[model samples]
Target: MKKPSRDFWKDSAFALASVALAFAYGSLTWKRDLPNLFRIRAGRPLAEQAQEPNPSLKFTGARGRPLRPFLFTGRTFDVFYFDHVNQPTAEFARATLQATSFTYATLPFANFNQADFRGSYFERASLRGADLRASHFAFTNIIQSDLTGADLRDADLTSARILLTKLEGALFNENTKLPFSEAEAIARGMKRAK
Candidate 1:
């Protein structure tokens, strides 16, 4: 009121300085973690992302041609049939098979044990009697495929689409990770291996 006291000025200066320092410290501390928090939202570099192989390109045959379904069976095993007569033979055992378009491809009696076929598209493809034990087929599409008598023991089918696929007699075990429950698979005519 009367005259500004020296102590008043000193208190004002200290308050201003304290606010400035707090702001500076906040900015400095936030800068370190800002990039990590916003990198994904701000579109991170492609190199930093988990890249998947081009499916159509990876499952190609000689000269970059798309491969056909392959089939083989021993005398002890039952006969398996694939409808693709014009496509070339292809096997996918212990391999990472990625195919964007495998419609009408036949792979009856083929061995796919311990293979990774995640996100593969297998529409109308025949996988009858195929040995797919211990395979990873998460997010795969097997619509309209013939999987009759196929072995799916210990296979991972999380979020996989098997609509209209022939799963009759297909073998799944307790170790198999199906997208649906065991009751649903059994209702759909899928059998559990004894």
Candidate 2:
């Protein structure tokens, strides 16, 4: 039998890593990937883009608690950041914020309802079920934030980027401020807009 060569594992790992990098890069370069990449890059830490997200640094939630605004009183986080917080559950809900730069935070379930997230950058944050009702997002940079189930009732998404995403469960009433055509369609439960 032939003996296994030295550095075999290293070479295999390198190849695998290379493949993963290529795939990720390819996905990012695609038109559909631009918004997400921009969102993630924008929210990256000033020191290191690859730094592991530390929710503890700017937040005061238990290990098991989700990333909710009510739970994260006076906490800090944003769009262009890496949010390894709540990785196990991948949740951030009901969080109150103001003038924070979250360009690319990876908050899949970030609940932003009833929270004050004015001037926050959610360009690429995954805002699924992030109840944004009665919140003020004026001039908030939400270029590519995922609004799949996010409730926009009474929320101000005016002048938001509103990139390609799902608006299935998002609510927008007269009290809400929208981007005219798109917002109107979304408010009426229209699909295929995002």
Candidate 3:
């Protein structure tokens, strides 16, 4: 058997060390850097993109479970529960996730812009600073949810059951459709967007 050269061993060690260093750097900065890495382009219609499956678009759910990529439209997520997990900064722009359950999920600053969430459950979910522009929430249950600073411009919330939900600093414009009166919406601390 032929012996390996000394230079080959040195190169192999260098490659392994480089891989380890990259992994450590990613782990240290993932929370701060991951959101910037996956930015959704604005003003692009969902129909403009091809319906091909994107394997690179993966999300982590509770207990490190892999979630379905948010690129697929009209996906029914029955009983999709996330128990008290902190999934801040999740991006679900232009996706359809109907009838999903988000009880006790902490998803502050999540991007749900133009997403169809009709008939979804958001009981006890923290959606502070979430970008929910032009999203659908018809007949959805939002009991005890925190929607402080959420952008609700042009979003439809017709018949949405919103009991004890926090709406402080939430922005809504004239295009936003709501089941209740505008006065009541304002009384709930939801501000009118200029």
The C-alpha stretches of model 3 lying farther than 4 A from their native spots are 1-60, 63-79
Candidate 2 lDDT tens digits, 172-194: 66677776676556564543312
Alpha-carbon local distance difference test for all models: 0.63, 0.54, 0.73
lDDT of 1 by residue, 36-109 (tens): 34421222222222132421112222222334333322111111112232233335567665434455666567
Q: Give the candidate number with the greatest TM-score.
A: 3
Candidate 3 lDDT over 75-130, as tens digits, reads 43442334444656767788776766677778788888998888788888899999
Count of clashes in candidate 3: 0
The alpha-carbon deviation from the true structure for residue 21 of candidate 3, after best TM-score superposition, in angstroms, is 48
Candidate 3 backbone collisions, by pair: none
Model 1 residue 20 CA deviation in Å: 71
Clash list (residue pairs), candidate 1: none
Candidate 2 ranges beyond 4 A from true positions: 1-70, 73-96, 182-184, 187-194
Decreasing lDDT order of the candidates: 3, 1, 2
lDDT of 2 at 186: 53
Task: Judging by TM-score, tell me the better candidate of 1 and 3.
Answer: 3
Best-performing candidate as measured by lDDT = 3
- lDDT accuracy of residue 168 in candidate 1: 86
